[model samples]
Target chain A: EPEVTQTPSHQVTQMGQEVILRCVPISNHLYFYWYRQILGQKVEFLVSFYNNEISEKSEIFDDQFSVERPDGSNFTLKIRSTKLEDSAMYFCASSRRTGSPLHFGNGTRLTVT
Target chain B: AQTVTQSQPEMSVQEAETVTLSCTYDTSESDYYLFWYKQPPSRQMILVIRQEAYKQQNATENRFSVNFQKAAKSFSLKISDSQLGDAAMYFCALSTGANSKLTFGKGITLSVRP
Candidate 1:
């Protein structure tokens, strides 16, 4: 089955650095999302993207975070400045339609020192 | 706000046996979706089963099935004849509607002993 693909399975960066996480959603999917899981916490929603615009975002998605569908297939999340608290596993997901079962990637583990 | 809770943090089952993972959710919306996802050591989130709140009939996929109690706000996953491969971290998640964000439970770890 087709699935979401995320690059750089593991990312390591110093505090105050900028990081961009990339994802290639399923070819036919229309809705995209970004979620994060702290080491021992529940998976939290970060943002949802549709039609090249953000549909909704959780409080965790603040001014430092931005998502862009630079092209038809690639969706990217950029963090202007990283902090130690930003360390987590970031998952990219997509769905054919609203409320459809979402397909997720293996996830990119971001580690900030 | 919608919240999903997985009461048990860990559970184990013998191979060929059956096990159930409990999940409870609180939601105000009448129409929504509930999902169970399995994440093995690789941490790849895999969809195990899904239930639509509007449908009374439970959702099943092969050996994976769900007992969805809409009125009770409970959705549990049952794994029958479990195999070693079934061992993984299972999560209960909810989405209010289309294009909405998912709220996930903390997740429960399942171990299938051989």
Candidate 2:
């Protein structure tokens, strides 16, 4: 079974530094999403992309956050300036289409120091 | 806005026994989907089961089953013949039609004793 893959399972960066989280969604999937889980908190939606544009986003996805499908295969989330609160497990997910169950990646643990 | 709630923070069950994790959700949309995801110590999120709001029958997959009460807005996961491997953090999530962005609950940690 094809699954979503994320690189740099663990990332540690300075508070003011820029960081990019990479994800390779399932080859055949059309919808891509990013979610984050702060320790002891519920998983929160960050953004969703389809047809090469952002479809929906949450408040947590602010000016510092941006997502792009740089190529046909890789989806990347870039944070311009990291903050302590940005530390969490970031998950990448993909679905065949809307209403389909999303398949998630193992997640990238981002630690903002 | 949709919200999923997992009231029990943790639960314990002996091997071969049964355990149920409760979840309730509030959603104004009549058309939506519910899902249970399991995260073991490795922290990999695994899909356990899914329930469609329009379906009257509950969803089941082998030892995993759901008691879905649409009227009560409740969706609970029942694990039968539990094994130590079943120990994990289970999350209840919801997504509305045409919008696959999932809204998840805090999650419940299940511990299966041998």
Candidate 3:
């Protein structure tokens, strides 16, 4: 089956540095999302995008966080400044439309020291 | 706001046996979808099964089935004839009636023994 794909399976960065996690969602999917899972914590939603604009976002998606679908095929989440708390497994998910089941990528493990 | 709870942090079952993971949620919306996902050592999130709140009949997919009590706000996953491959962390997730931004539970680690 076709699946979502993420780049840089693992990312290691220092505090204050920036990082961009990339994802290539299923070719036919229209809705995209970014979620994070702190070690030993539940996955939390970060933001959702459709039609190149953000539709919904969680409180955790603050000023330092931004998402861009710079191209037709790539969805990227950029963290302007990293903190130790920002270290987690970032997941990219996509669905055909609202109310549909999301298909997730293996995830990008971001580690900030 | 909606919250998902997985009370059992860990569970164990012998190979070829059965095990059930429990989940509960708090949501005022009458329409929603519930899902069970498995995360293994690779940390890949795999969809196990899903249930629509409006459906009255429990859903079964091969060895995986769900006991969904809509009124009680309870949804449980039962894995029958468990195999060692079933040992992984299972998460329960909920999405709004019309959206797919999933709210997930803390997760339950299942261990299948020989």
The C-alpha TM-scores of every prediction are 0.98, 0.98, 0.98
> In model 3, which regions exceed 4 Å deviation?
none
Q: Which stretches of candidate 2 lie over 4 Å from their true place?
A: none
Please list the C-alpha lDDT of all candidates, in the order they appear: 0.93, 0.94, 0.94
lDDT of 3: 0.94
Q: Ten residues in a row with the worst lDDT in model 2 chain B? A: B94-103
Task: After the best TM-score superposition of candidate 3, give how far the Cα of residue B15 lies from its true spot, in angstroms.
Answer: 0.6
Best candidate, DockQ-wise?
1
Q: Write down the worst ten-residue block by lDDT for model 2 chain A.
A: A93-102
Worst 10 residues of 3 chain A by lDDT: A97-106
* Model 3 clashing residue pairs (backbone): none
Error of 1 at B55 (Å): 0.9
Cα lDDT of model 2 by residue, B43-113, tens digit: 88899998988899999999999999999999999999999999999999998857588999999999999
| Candidate 1 local lDDT, residue B84 | 93
- Which lDDT tens digits does candidate 3 get at residues A1-113? 99999999999999999999999999999999999999888899999998889989999999999999998999999999999999999999999987788999999999999
Model 1 residue B111 CA deviation in Å? 0.8
